[model samples]
Target: MRDRSTGHPRNAWYALAASAEVGSTPLGTRALGTPVVLYRAGDGSVVALGDRDAHRPYPLSLGHVDGDTIVSGYSGFAYDRTGACVRVPSQAQVPYGARVPSYPVVEEGDLVWVWLGEPSLAALRPPVSTPWLTDAGWDTFGGAWETAAGIGLLHDNFADITHVAVVDPVISPPALTGVAPALEVELTETTVHFHRDWPAAPLPEWQAKISGASTTASYPQREEGAFLAPGLWADRWDVFIPADEGGTQTFRFTHAVTPVDDHRTRHLWRVSRNFAPGAEASDVLRPIFESYYLKVREILETMQQVIDRDGYGEDVNVAADLAALQVRKILRRLVADEG
Candidate 1:
């Protein structure tokens, strides 16, 4: 995503995932690690802002059609599209106005762009990664795992698959024995291709040992370290880009983490498909898939316990760590450059 004014991504990297009906609203989210408030305009535009105090219920966008004045929030504050307070609630036909801050925002493509930083610095926030989500039949399944390290460590963990030998009971990647074929890396301004789908057997042993997927042709195409490759990214890693009509799709599976603070975190995820809500998993796994969800959560819950009780430090490194390290460095540069 690019800043409408400065044409920079450092300003914002996520778009609103909501539609613009006068009553339509979306739960706020953190994009590029920045907490934000998102709202849609009735005419099909999204506005994102830096402030995210849901209690205040201050709206960042209100779907204004006049090309100006935006009805901000339940508390009542009307502002221009650029975030300038155009009308005060207290001064409305009746009194009882509210006071708050607002910032300029714009909607383009399928993403919402907000200028949270100083308009002057918006030009410096360069793009770091590209996204690869879709509006197609994409199903997403995610979970949060505690690492023996920090966010940086988590990145290293996903880049490789050696530790599964010790943590997993079944699913195993033969190449993980330090003998697997080298992973291929393709890098470009708006894309990164790590196209190595090392083979995997559909055996119980292989399935049990899996916690994350690293080998794949598919990857996210976010403007940052844009990782996108067509075809099945790998045997265990399939990122089904969601479709527009909210049609059915599936997210193979993987892990992600959200920081609670320096030492704490919150983790939540879901597996969705374009199929009608009543549809079942394909015939092969349908019989057993429902049970796996519980089992998977149970195992991951235990994993987090270890981290909470024991805390963690790191020592060893693996090949998978490389891509993750690169991604981190690239992100740091974007943040620093923006500053």
Candidate 2:
């Protein structure tokens, strides 16, 4: 198969899976079109390796994890965390060349990150970190789903929030679309930031709960959307709920898109809230949060399908597409720089 992953830079870290996904079993997945296997070492650190065995064609992911080694199911070949062939049952002595390719991996901020790039560059730039996921007094809920469109499309969608009208109209504040907030745009070497202030907007359930505002009232709000190099996007929305104590709640949404191939993308996402933290709050809100997240996932899947089915050439852009257009421009420039 053609490796479309070559179109993008390989000198950056990409999120492979959730931190909770890697455990006793070897998790089979792909990064930049390369087959990869993820597992935890004896010390609980995450390790990544090429899924294909050097001697045989069997995938190492199909094998089992035994302590610090992964045992091939077919020939009982054992490989260490470094992808070094430690034992070969079929032969008395393991050949020095019998080794699989090992990729640098790290677990940070509740996610597994693999560096599919130059070994030296891996240390210079780590994976995009979301501190709110683990910060004190913050509750996080996360889940991931694949899409048909490229990571660019997803990033564009986030940069432009107007889609909330059609995607999930019930939850999006009126100020998100009803009023045109002046956009403050900032561009750095490898990131773009946009901030907007809405003088009046209706608050959703989650926002209302923290703001202590009635559902029927419209309140002032602020939104900030940012995109990092490669494929990391973050959005922060704050609703100023009118309360006797004077309160405001901020919600953060993050997306890390890793290209699986030209037509497929693996998305790792999380939503963090500062208003509610710990089990007591989660016990009552988990179901509601999960329900909303599922809907958001569905919207992403639908967007990808629409893009793949219709193609970008057949679509048109409008005034609200300003942010998305900028994102596309940035991605195009970045991709060209990789070349």
Candidate 3:
């Protein structure tokens, strides 16, 4: 097992928040244990900087956003989007060391990503791309939420869906518990994909609603999920009712987990669907999908409690845990390489 103090990889782009979250006001949060402040500049581009003011230790996030700069409420220290301290209200000449660190940030996939490591590496890799998220034909809804579990554990939850049996039976039927899935694994340099099929599985209530199918009917469901290196997970779900070909619905679920600290993570989850696209998507299914994501959040919180008390490593591994195990191996390698 890796040390909690080891932290997450710094060279990767971590999703900080939804694009809309950083508007006129500065948003303050932690990513990979680093306090960061994000806001939009006068040109409508996202800017990221160290949240803490170097001089007074006040959070720059608490301050106000001036055109292209952040004006600290205390002492009136102002910093430009590049993290350069350009204004000192009391002094005529600003010292060279007065500037806060500027972080590289990019807005993509309807999310904002900030680089916490070597700035040069920011150009090497872009944020996790969810083309569906920004596509006009897909209905998208997402938000950020905090959870007690470390990012690794939260990601493990995504790599393995068998937990849905014991922890989230309501999302799907417990039949997946007794049945063993024939899993197909696809390995890559930076990501691991798992293809799973649940034959003749009864659709959950939420699935039924978005899929536009009868709740009682059984369907052949297929899911393809991938664990992206560093801290991202994406699952594409296809629910098909046997008789109705047009009734099949496709859902893309994406998760970006940023380790706030060793034991806490700020997570952004988005659900996109192609069945009902356009503006009407929100009016029709946003509420139901929002509730669905919240329910999973609650489940993860509960899982965190259990892990804190009893802990892992002692539990027996089953066939269902193969993908999760592989994810851990890949993550361990990524962490070691970073070190």
The model with the greatest lDDT is 3
Give the higher-lDDT candidate: 2 or 3: 3
lDDT of 1: 0.38
Once fitted onto the true fold, the runs of candidate 1 whose alpha carbons sit more than 4 angstroms away are 1-12, 15-23, 29-35, 50-75, 92-154, 163-179, 187-192, 197-200, 203-278, 282-314
lDDT of 3 by residue, 1-339 (tens): 323323577888888888889987999998877889999999999999999887788999999998999988786899998898999998999877789999999888788988898898889887777788889877887767888778877876787776665654656543475575788888876788998887776666765665566777677778789987576788988877554445677788888888888678888888888775566555666666566567777877776677677665455777767787787777677778887
Can you tell me which runs of candidate 3 are displaced by over 4 Å? 1-6, 173-178, 209-211, 214-218, 241-247, 277-295, 306-312
In model 1, the number of clashes is 54
The Cα error of candidate 1 at residue 185, in Å, is 3.2
Score every model by TM-score.
Answer: 0.51, 0.88, 0.89
C-alpha RMSD of each candidate structure in angstroms: 10.5, 3.3, 2.8
State how far residue 205 of model 1 sits from its true place (Å): 9.3
lDDT of each: 0.38, 0.76, 0.79
Q: Single out the weakest 10-residue window by summed lDDT for candidate 3.
A: 1-10
In the range 102-196, model 1's lDDT, one tens digit per residue, is: 44454332223345556665445432221222335443333333322233333334445545655543333333433444566666543334534
Q: Tell me the TM-score of model 2.
A: 0.88
- For model 1, where is the 10-residue window of minimal lDDT? 223-232
Q: Where does the lowest 10-residue lDDT sum fall in candidate 2?
A: 1-10
lDDT of candidate 3 vs native?
0.79
